[model samples]
Target: MAGEITETGELYSPYVGLVYMFNLIVGTGALTMPKAFATAGWLVSLFLLVFLGFMSFVTTTFVVEAMAAANAQLRWKGMESRQEEDDDNSSTASDSDSLLQDNYERAEKRPILSVQRRGSPNLFEITNRVEMGQMASMFFNKVGVNLFYFCIIVYLYGDLAIYAAAVPFSLMQVSCATGNDSCGVEADTKYNDTDLCWGPLRRVDAYRIYLAVFTLLLGPFTFFDVQKTKYLQILTSLMRWIAFAIMIVLALVRIGRGHGEGHPPLASLSGVRNLFGVCVYSFMCQHSLPSLITPVSSKRHLTRLVFLDYVLILAFYGLLSFTAIFSFRGDSLLDMYTLNFASCDIVGVAAVRFFLGLFPVFTISTNFPIIAVTLRNNWKTLFHREGGTYPWVVDRVVFPTITLLPPVLVAFCTHDLESLVGITGAYAGTGIQYVIPAFLVYHCRKDSQLAFGPGAVNKHRSPFHHTFWVGFVLLWAFSCFFFVTANIVLSETRL
Candidate 1:
């Protein structure tokens, strides 16, 4: 059964919807792209990034189509319930039996509404809000629904781990005294975690301390509801734009001054595996579409809006990655691109340097709590039983504790942002982005065919509606899993 629509907030225009989607898709993932591009070479990264962008867009449409189908199913069931109620009322009223019979005959002749034919499709109406979880329950068999939730849970865990590591790593970079103190130093210099921080603590020890501090501050918020206020979103978005623009402009200036030192290869087959994962991670938005799309007042041009957004995003990624690979040597490029500008010489002004240094710290800090709460809720939903209630301890303490601990522990073990992003995106991210949407759209199409017969058509059907597209997505997903698995196995053996 579809759950009750819980998001009853103010509706927004399509323009706002576009911005929301842009912000959601272009988050922490983009910070790690420049490094991946550097490792994989510019030509190969460019081709793979573009191809992945197209594939992600195709699946996004699949998700929107599934949402419309879920809404139609809910509307059909409600209509059936009302029809049954009318029949019962008509039978019970003995005093007006003749009148009821005449009205019933008229109804039979005209059929309450022509569109309400017993098996006709209700494709045009978009009234209900069916979440991804609800849509899974509606269309997926028992095993499919369970797997969907499992995939989502794993994806969210990765998201939290990335966030957990990012915030502390950024803090360490800014607060510690390190080599390459000036941006004009050798482009290939390396910094190790064993280097000293402030007084006695090594950089790695400081990182652990910061992680503990981060967990203490943000962990409690998971137990409570997190309402991301409008003003806070705007502020963070403003900071994000400023940070990105500064990175691009700084890279352009450095490259223009004949300081360009990168010599990336034409293609590096070894790096392609990790690059694919990073690109896939960057284009993720399917899981959050229900919450994002429901509040938009105008959806007639949603497809067009999504197309424009993707085009803009692709161009932005190309610009950012191209400049970074040219301006800095491949080995020197930081996992988080903003740190490349943290040095005083590259960004002369101390204020600008500070802003760029702390950019991720500011923006991702806000998102950490929100994601933690979402993960907690998904845990509850996964184990929840109908007409059953959890004990106070499990509801308040156990769920929150489990939700907060795993990712924190993962962050403590290592701060390798590239590997973290690569693994998460390649595995759980693939299931959430490619496999699930393909199956949801395929099943939704089949269910509609059975319910409304051959003549029925979904008004919101994906442009890539052929069954071959679904197979292609699944095939791509399988191939990715195989390649990543093989790479891991070979690397382990070599070690």
Candidate 2:
């Protein structure tokens, strides 16, 4: 059961792999981008979004290279183990004396087995299933591996908080009776906790109720194993495409009809902080590359496929954000863009309005449980001792309780999805996407050089293989953190 849960059988072509990556990167973050674009101004948003996308693609290549190197090392170790077993079986009394000498020589040469390979193509075989955790163990020191897990855990926590808030927020938007039902109505009427919902309960109270209901329904799944089947992915991808297409076309039509009310600025330094976070969040697929890339039938053009995927995603985000900023005033765009179409004036048909409004509900609901289960597993891995079994209470109760609580409590406190995404993407997201990959590739290259020698070539190395690229990424990550921190300090001082 554990093996089945962990292993995703290789069942996809390079094209399918591209699509899967595209879907993975362009999730909830993309939905919130238009508002960020409007706030940062279109020009700054465009430059930053493109730049961030390029950086994300670079790190993606880095991860892929590390994965290949990991596979090579694992293969080398397996062959060495088999040879040792054979030697043990075939040893004779006469050979015992020579065996000691051979052992000394082997002890000297064993480290080389990981880096130096004979002239066999099989030595560089890419069939191993080296997950990020396993690769961290292989390449990173104990501290680095723990840091990697910690970064991932924090990012996943942010994901859960965003998901928890988004679903309930969407529900409140569509089901609550108080909001205007017509599209392009008054744009400034922000609903508050005091706003009535369903006769007696206020909107904030309704939101909490939804959060509790959400926890009750999906929280239990965290205690047990869960896998997202191919069919589930296909269904969600289908819904995503349909919803996005409707939005883009609807916004374009509205603009063509001269109904566009938005005049976004060309640049806004004040909004750059959140915009940075949103773009970082949108281009996040680095942490999931192992599951995404490993199943490809052929990876000769894996880099090209990933590049194309990012290109499409960048184009999609640009189109979505551009249309949104043009079609609606900056203040009017919802955190979840699908809500924009959930009115009679924009979408006309009641069915379409409800479908678009509830899109987050459908998509995020499926994801919340999966993410919760993943967070639970990460906790187990973090404290797991070798040859040790966890107490049933710890396994089934404590981890799930911790996993389900913090994010839900966050959702309970506020449904500020934009700030949640911005902070998550800016900090933890930056670490996972930028800083960690830079270090991973840097160290992986050093390790490969030590194992395979300086002249050894890695087939999967990034096009930006120069050591300068690593420094550039780390430098950029530092600049971003510095800028965000300064912005926060400055904003609070002004307040």
Candidate 3:
């Protein structure tokens, strides 16, 4: 009880919020997004960026609001806990009364930041009072939030493995790009290339094992105390942005020069393309919109914070997509420039191709944990419980590990990137990123209140803000589901 977080849902420090958002968006997409430009074309890809950006904002806002609800509930529970402590002989009645009086006086006397407590329960009761039945509604809310997180975890692990499989296949091709006669050139018509090379470290079946490891590591990463995990978050984020730039360059080089004959991005399968179907849906490592609405968020500062995030997200994504589109050949998508680089530059473009080729590895390394956290917090808020608290280790490690296992196993078993991407994108990506959020948001908005919060330097609150959030989530879900599913069906006979 001593260490119990009595006042939950407090907005974490701004640094954490900013980092978290950045982290989420900048992952595997860095490598794969360029390929999207190739398929959709620059114009379509830009539109995709805009559409995804807007939906992602809305979904992020909804998440923020939901977090606020949970945090507020955490605070309320804390108040109740104190009441119980007082009743259980925390001190003599006289002492308690005196302390109460002193607290009242001190609260009034504290600095300007300490405002008068004026908010009501702010929770939806099945029927306003009895307090206990509210538990059910609370449970539903938390479950919804945590459920979202769980899906994300599932999606990321499977996604990461699928992407990772592409890496080795790309490495194999470096030899011929430099005009080395030693590099056996495979016949394009035959769909056979002798110049391609796999990573030196891999076994014929290494993909399976790698996928398992990448997928399962979410536990060690996420459960290790997020409070102190800032460093790893930063490192990953840097990698993400750098990768983004590299992707753009790759796309530009291929798309710009009129290669008399177009080269197909070696990764032509639909499954692999899903990595760029929509936004990264990452847990940004830093003043993200989600943090703005958490119960702990300073009400005075909420509006400005949310809008700032919206702008930052828009700018980052829009720019990245634009550059990526310019980097590829028009006719060929996925890895259109697959044969453009020689083996000598294998360290350069080849490394880029490998990672870009392997989207899931980057995703599983990060996104799974973020989504799980989303679920846990939402669960607590909905249930309004300190009891049966969500276990961090389960989602962070066990669940994520389990989710990634199949991809890794498949990679090793088949060494086939095409199959894994198709299955995961059709099933997991479709449901998690697109369908579910959209559905949940629609339901929430049907009978709700609130509007989007204000811009920064202009802090203000809106009534029925929750309603707006529901709408936002729905947008993201639908986008993800439709785009991913369509592509999967196109690429695979199985899906």
Candidate 4:
């Protein structure tokens, strides 16, 4: 009964949806969005901001529906079990656990002592009639699953490189809340040109490493009980609302002082790119996809959801931009804007500021699982061939190492934070999000022209249609090439 709810929307709370969006767009790009505001200016910026929201909505919805459908069919076993899995889908015991935590914990500890073979259990075999599993078999299926698997990894990298950039970016905003002298901006200018210079970041610099380490620590410690953090969902909705309010109040305040204030014009394009990425991330059908694929995702819901989600994303972004623009007085950097940067003691809005400050810890907590897996698995897959049937031998010993790697690497090899982070946008950032999905969508879609799979373009289309797909393929290929080259150049220059 509980498991069913887990798969079903009944157990799927709105806050989980909010986390998806926050995780999707909240990272490093929040800082860079100012650059977009600067490049496009306020007016053009609005349209660009919205355009990203729109496209992401459409693409994400499609990806979610399609990929999830595939996951459902593939995750489980035979046709009979697949059908049973769907029926039990919403009824899965874990689904019930969400409503009652104590019972769930009690259940988890129950011994699997069912004469459980001491040897490696066949992952392929199903003990029950209704079991549907990750159950990877064929090479292509494994590869396909791994492809979507990339999303979780890149998601964190973006947060670390993109969102983490905001710590420094928010400094400038902090300076405004207080004075430059008190904020220590002028003095820090002689020290580090990182996000601290953006506002009141100097105050936190001495403890930034400690803060970063603390955040890193928080992610894994809570791993065994992530759902316990579900209470945070309520807070997420509140912050988003606060952010919305801040955007409005601040935009109105800065109406005349604008013109070309916060994020400029071309920056909007990148804003669009990140939005597109978020939509992809949010619309990702992976978590929910494996359960109900075809019927549950009716075309109507898809259309409405896409439209609504994008509008909200843009609305939220526009607000953030407005608040940051006037607050910084036009000197804002792309990777340095935190909502709390200018906020220390505004009694009325102090809560918003506090959460803004807490945002990094949240991101690190959410992202570390994916990073640990990426670091550990990639380590084993690439370097360590020795494997135990037990996943823990690999997962436990090396997961902590992966968590600690980022700080250690950054500490050892110092580089410009903004430029260094922006550079990641080209490689892991590019391939993990953009290139991989585009390939999956194109390949899986029945008539997609760029499908790397066997039957993409079929006998059905007109010459014009054929030309359109061919052109589309070229466009993606072009983008991929550019992204790869950009990374190479950026990495080389930094080295």
Candidate 5:
């Protein structure tokens, strides 16, 4: 009974949904967070992480409410279609009388604003999937929908770029550790691109080689339908948990044995810009909420489940980041946290080092194709027209080529994962995590009230239903843009 299949998708218990949300929110961004935290200073990072987590939670609730509203809109439209069908069908006088009597009885049983149940879920029950793009179309005007697509497209591009860079970066770091060559290197020594990887081959060149290999191997999937199999999902999730657990335990042991090397400052403004962005990126799941929320069998405690999930994610991120900062110096930290354990001096076992070094390669390699295909599909959707079909080349080649090239080029140009993450999260992430939800909830509220009237209630209405909260979210998004841009300007000026 707990697991039911609908036309849209299979349903799971709310607890499973909670786990999915947690997994979605704590991906690559969490790994990049400790360095940002260390650079920004513990005190500042702590305050910002907590505040961003709360803000993310609020926006998540907004998205949930918007989901309910989207469902209601779909249901309302379905009713209208059915009504038209009924009106078209001729009936005998007695049948017409029976229909009128039934309508009157239902009206007497419910309020004027209430919709008649036709053996379907309640109007506001989220039993169907409403993709963010669909919701945007329902709630926003043309300009707004275009802006929504642009923001999300940019975010996905950044995601692909990050994945493209990270896999190669991890491979380079691991491949560089051969025989006895890098064993003598100090733990705090930051290798430059010019550094030797194998004999005369430069690290940067090695990175490019791996990048080419990664592209050649996984790039073709963008042109075709590829999905993460259940087994693959399970494998990646297991690796993720094992990798994080190993890092945390090693950090704790390092601190316990009196070999701790980190001493972060109380506060620092220089790192705040990146930290803010990283925090925002780490907490991002709003864009994918529909896919996650619609499958839940019971949404009675959905908000509560979401709140609990956020709390767990926050605590896990804190544990990972805090342990990392105290266990390693800020300068010694790698953009990929797992790479920090790629040395024998840290993990002491060659196999463990190799596993930690290549973990991102394994996990990210699987995800890159999925994201690329998604981006390609989005491009197709963006330009798609009513009653029009694309040419074979445009359908098959053009979209995939455009989707796969830019991010790969970006990855080719630079592999500065920190800057990639910072800029991506600060701008595109803000639009997704903050701006989109605020507007969606606000617009959806207005539309729902207009369609269903004031007395109609949305069972999944956000706790922060006041107009002030919506305004606050939009104001905060704008403030983030201003803050990040100013910081970039100041940093450039100083340089």
Candidate 6:
């Protein structure tokens, strides 16, 4: 908790918190989902999506409970520290009464309406933001904490790689013409990197040029702090909603006209690996739960709010993917689904095509710097020592360079957004979403029971509070890693 920045702004109602959670979970992942759905087949995708969403919700509750436990621990320690100070000072009776009144007033400010009588269950309320990293430090051993940082670092790298590739890929699709006559590329024509963009420029060459421009433009912010402005968030969210609405509407209209070209198989194991990864990524809000959940003015029905949000997200995903798979042939689907509409033959409107293509460019460019700075800070934290300072060059230059270089190099190697996303979601996302939550809840519960009496109850405990659920989550995580690794091996062998 010491290293993390807690949310200090005004708290909102739970409904507003619900909307924030929804916005957080449904970003880049949703755009790539339609292709995964088509590849894995509609029926399988639907079932898997529903099941994974449920699993994610269960883990989210686990995280919320851990937060409450963390807050309780901090509160209990503060009280103990005050009591120790009072004892050392040998305070008079009046002073003791005054201190007691002060503590009660502070407790009253929180949801708990009672005084902190030593071992009281009511004193443990989630009135503060305890981030996942802080929780890891509290509960995990030294090695476990290091592993947590490593997993997060890997996930952020994958995130940067995706953002790096997406902007230029979108730009290439929008600017390139098949024959240099200003006619847009056809939807069905399979263009490889070797295909001409301009007369002498290959599509890959054009993408690299844009990649360099993108890096030069946005990469410098890694060295400086870049926070998302309130207006920037509003603008990006507005564009996101408009673009998604357009795509869904267009797909429905196309399908209604009986021009639907997708006839997906009932099931396909070959696509299961990526679909698993994609669903995990899509349902991911566990890592940032503290930031999103702590600002809720009331959390009495927090679990129900989370369930409702998941239901809506699942419905939205179904609508988007089903409509998309039906609107376009499976073979013609693009890795970035928006580019599928950038083709003039599919969209028929130049402005709409360009807007759809440029949407990620606008949103991701804003996000890349924030994420890079965060990764750099995390690097700083990992190597940080007590009562010591980093040198200017290492603190300012070294960490940022290491953070930016790997992802850019990955982008330079290949613009395979699907593979990058799949690997990221499957491995690092698994650790963050599933394994970490399970262990956090497990250890936090034990710590809570020990700190408070055995009879103390955590009001925010998950519905799946039994130890069975925690074991089940860990088992599931291991199985997922195994399955994904095997699939990757088989695919490579065939290749």
lDDT of each: 0.86, 0.85, 0.44, 0.42, 0.89, 0.87
In model 4, the Cα lDDT at residue 299 comes to 28
Question: Taking the tens digit of each residue's C-alpha lDDT, what string does model 6 give over 82-125?
Answer: 96787556545458777678667756776552233534655557
Ranking by TM-score: 5, 1, 6, 2, 4, 3
Q: Candidate 1's error at 176, in angstroms?
A: 0.6
lDDT, candidate 5, 358-398, per-residue tens = 89999999999999999998898888899999999999999
Tell me how far the alpha carbon of residue 97 in candidate 2 is from the true structure, in angstroms, after superposition.
11
Give the runs in model 3 whose Cα sits over 4 Å from its true position.
Answer: 1-16, 87-153, 163-229, 246-318, 330-404, 413-495
Ranking of predictions according to lDDT: 5, 6, 1, 2, 3, 4
Find the candidate with the highest lDDT and give its number. 5
Candidate 6 Cα lDDT to native? 0.87
In model 2, where do residues sit more than 4 Å from their true spots? 1-8, 92-122, 177-189
Cα TM-score per model = 0.94, 0.92, 0.57, 0.59, 0.95, 0.93
Better of 2 and 3 by TM-score: 2
Which is the better candidate, 3 or 4, if ranked by TM-score?
4
List ranges where model 5 is wrong by over 4 Å: 91-121, 179-185
Off by over 4 Å in 1: 1-8, 95-107, 111-122, 178-188
User: Model 4, stretches more than 4 Å misplaced?
Assistant: 1-28, 39-55, 68-77, 80-155, 161-208, 211-216, 219-228, 256-300, 322-329, 339-393, 411-421, 445-474, 483-495
lDDT per residue for candidate 1 within 1-495, as digits (tens), equals 122333545677788889999999999989999999988888999999999999999999999999988887787778779978876786676557776786778678886544446345455445567789999999999999999999999999999999999999988887773432434222354678998776788889988999999999988999889988989999999999989998899899988998877778778888887798889999999999988887777688888999999999999999999999988888888888888777655777878887888899999999999999988999999999999999999999999999999999999999999989999999999999999999999999888767666566677778999899999999999999999999999989989
- The best candidate by TM-score is 5
Query: How many collisions per candidate?
Result: 0, 2, 69, 46, 0, 0
What is candidate 2's lDDT per residue for 288-383, written digit by digit as tens?
A: 888778777778888898999989999999999999999998888878888877666677777788888889999999998899998999999999
lDDT of 3 by residue, 335-380 (tens): 4223322222222434554454333344344555554444344333
